[model samples]
Target: MDLREYSVFDIMGPVMIGPSSSHTAGAARLAKIARQIAGDDVKEVQFILYDSFANTYKGHGTDKALVAGIIGIDPDDERLSHSFELAKEQNISFSFVKSDKDASHPNTVRMVIKNKSGDVIEVLGSSIGGGNVVLKEINGMSVEFTGEYETLITKHIDKPGIIAMVTKVLSEHMINIAFMRVYRQLKGDMAIMVIESDQTIPEDVRIRIEHIDGIEKAIVVDSINKA
Candidate 1:
């Protein structure tokens, strides 16, 4: 076999120090992205790793890397060397579970997060390759994003004119949304909107969004470059 002709995976194969950069590093990045989506002041986090991730998470540092990432640590940070202990020091509660499901990518992970105010969020993501990731779902919404944008994620009851209301608020603040995606469950009763913007949303706008009717929760995630 011409190793050079093959993708990096073919050359490197499965790794143990980490489950190839695509899985472990990508998992770390996904965790970081989830934290970004959850915003700061996070208190508790639950991680669900699927398929191959479940089989070798420990050896790959997927567990440690994940906890470390959630705490706002970089994947390559040596502090990850003691992430389990560091997480304890930081008082960031974290746990992990393994699941067998065809619903998610083989390298997928789902994050259930809670902030200090008790606001809860659930995000699903996948580690694609080359330490890159795509946020595949949020709050049960099937969406595709690179997880790098400064974003606002809102969960609410689906109703008429909610998008207009939210967008109007953002527009009034001069925040330009680069893209918007919505996910709704069962006749649009419960919904989630993921808004990617060119820049961060102001605190005042965020506060205003919280007051919007039908909005259950609003979270502002700074870009990973900023985090």
Candidate 2:
């Protein structure tokens, strides 16, 4: 038999401003990551709630938390309660819709965000439980990643040596990769690379990666699970 040790967070959940960890904390984290993927210049956002989230979002303050996150507020921030007003002041429009997805997790929401540049991103994720969340899909591509670590996400053309080039840049910057995954739909098509690093990824490093051949976009997200 294998044994493992659990941290205080595992039992008590994350420190956050919330009535429920799953509904508030986890929802905030998921929305924040979605905004990071879509860029901070988002002009508008649509949150499509599913199952449990659709049924009880307002009561649990999930709607407020989601709005706060997309606009760069932390879960523990006092301002989380007034996220809607903040969004209005920032000129960021948002709407929420109820959706029923078959075979989907109970606490799932899909975010469709459009930036000022007219680029749109669709992100699907779920707050599993206890303030933990997993990103399941980006655009139309299937992906799996947790925003627990400082993450690097890249959109690029799928080709031989592309992975090596990106890794080489990370190695040069002395960034240690804790985990990495690549997702693509078809051969020689567009691909996404998700890298979880043991250290924070600087914005300059992300820019360096973006300038690499075959790379289209690169984004760095700070660890959301950190205390």
Candidate 3:
């Protein structure tokens, strides 16, 4: 098996404000990814923290960190100390529930967020140490993407040539796709496509994708949080 070498910074730590990178920093990033999926109109959020996060989140400021992220603050920001007050000021209601499920990652966090229009979405993520995170699930579909590239998530009905049509739009925009993956519930039912690209996907590309014949939802996210 090939081994991935750890950088010095990876071995040491990331510049962050937290008691534990896994509990606090990782949790913050997890919430940040969830916020991206839920969009800015979020009104209420429910966090389902599992294992270590559930047991010691309060003590380690993991709860505050998650709230800070939902408000668009990074883990390294000083405002993380006042995340609770900030959340209250925004009127974003939230609840934390703990559960231990077999076959689930210990550092997993599942978030259910609701918007003003009563639109609700669920996202699951895991913090993989050193402030890095992975987007695990979206709206009950199993998908995965690292927060390392300009990512696009699309939900559509499974059909032939849909992938080609989507990529063609991106190509027209001159966007280079670094990675692409498709996941489906069944052969001909719903499907989720994840694309991580070298450059940000333009708003027009997203709209065009949404306008496609079979596409249902098209979400464009920047790993740099530019969106």
| Top model number, TM-score | 2
- Score every model by TM-score: 0.79, 0.96, 0.91
lDDT of 1 by residue, 1-227 (tens): 64556567546743323546876677777888788677766789999888877878888888888887788777556776588898888898999999877645677788999988898878898877767678877766776777567878888898898899999999988999999998887676888888989988888898899789999888787665454
List where candidate 1 sits over 4 angstroms from the true fold: 1-20, 36-39, 114-120
Relative to the true structure, candidate 1 reaches a TM of 0.79
Reference-based lDDT, residue 221, model 3: 71
**Local distance difference test scores for all models:** 0.79, 0.91, 0.85
RMSD of each: 5.4, 1.4, 2.2
- For residues 123-216, could you state the per-residue lDDT of candidate 2 as single tens digits? 9999998888999999979888889899999999999999999999999999999999999999899999999999988888899999999999
Least accurate 10 contiguous residues by lDDT in model 1: 10-19
lDDT of 3: 0.85
Instruction: Return the lDDT, model 3, position 205.
Output: 86
Candidate 2 displacement at residue 154 in angstroms? 0.7
